[model samples]
Target: MWDSRTPGIPDELFERTEEVPITKEDVRALVISKLRLREGQSAIDVGCGSGSITVELCLQTRGEVHAIDFDQNAIELTKKNLKKFGVSAHVVQGKAQDVLPELPQVDAVVVGGTWGDAGKVIELAVGRLKKGGRIVIDTILIETMYHALAKVSELQLADIDVTQVTIAKARKVTTGTMMLARNPVLLISATKP
Candidate 1:
């Protein structure tokens, strides 16, 4: 079992200058571990948000990373994080489904926030993936999870794995600590046959 309590990249490194969503360090750790990234293998991150995942991917792999998001502010924030970490990625400010076709074939894909386009993005990503490549999706919505699972199955991807993670943290109260539950997230992963 992997513990996300400690992340390779500390959460404080990020500068949340703008109002944009960022993946928590713990969840980012799990997603990175599950992707099984290799050195020099290309990866794409759809809905990169604040580039928390993008920065981690860049640090974890020597391969090229294409970070895409529909929000320009999110793209800028991603760029800021990448710069802060002294890493690089192709940050594109556009809808993932529209920009995915322009990206090079990749060995891995991470869908962190699809924005109601999980099915379409997964379908496109799988098609653009190389054989033996992996796709990992993180969704907070059951509907999105179902859509990703169905699409991965329909695409005939192998080694399908789905996990629901409910994480709680101990917050300090006046006298002692209390358990504070974060939103549960579903992780779906598959490999191109």
Candidate 2:
């Protein structure tokens, strides 16, 4: 449904559920900016969820796309969205720790979930990231963010940056519009050295 070259696709267009999270539009834009993907640069979405980020990566890079998630329902939902958007990605139903090692080196990676194994997940992703490659990890938990930051630094990644994104959108209310803030995320971006 989204045929634009621009990155921010509205969140409502993607098939979503409470169990499977889709990166909100504003956050997706920031993540895409951090990735700095160019045409034909391959990427992997470590936690595909509703495939929102996966579809964006596919459109942005026009390169090989791989998506991994541990939940089967999430996998199915991802496939549906991929089909809906007429984009293709190799959707793998497995944990990042297990799936990331098998994939070929890529230009960028976006990790959305770690299943409480942020340290190992970041390590594996970095292992497969090509030299000069970019990686972005989104986590709401302070502990997870801290763990990811430490892991990326320990791996000696370059151009490391992290932003605590707090976004709010205006909504119609009685006689006026009100701003409602979405949950904050610690967005981490780095490049393999």
Against the reference, the lDDT scores of all candidates come to 0.86, 0.93
- Checking candidate 2 for backbone clashes, the offending pairs are none
Off by over 4 Å in 2: none
lDDT (tens digit, per residue) of candidate 1 on 1-193? 1123234566677867547988778888888888888878889999999898988888778679999999989988999888887889999988888999999899899998777988899998887799999889998999999899899988988999999989888899999999999999999988998
lDDT tens readout by residue for model 2, 108-143: 999999999999999999998999999999999999
Q: Which stretches in model 1 have alpha-carbon errors above 4 Å?
A: 1-8
Using lDDT, give the best candidate's number.
Answer: 2
TM-score, cand. 2: 0.98
TM-score of each: 0.93, 0.98
Q: Which lDDT value does model 2 have at 149?
A: 89
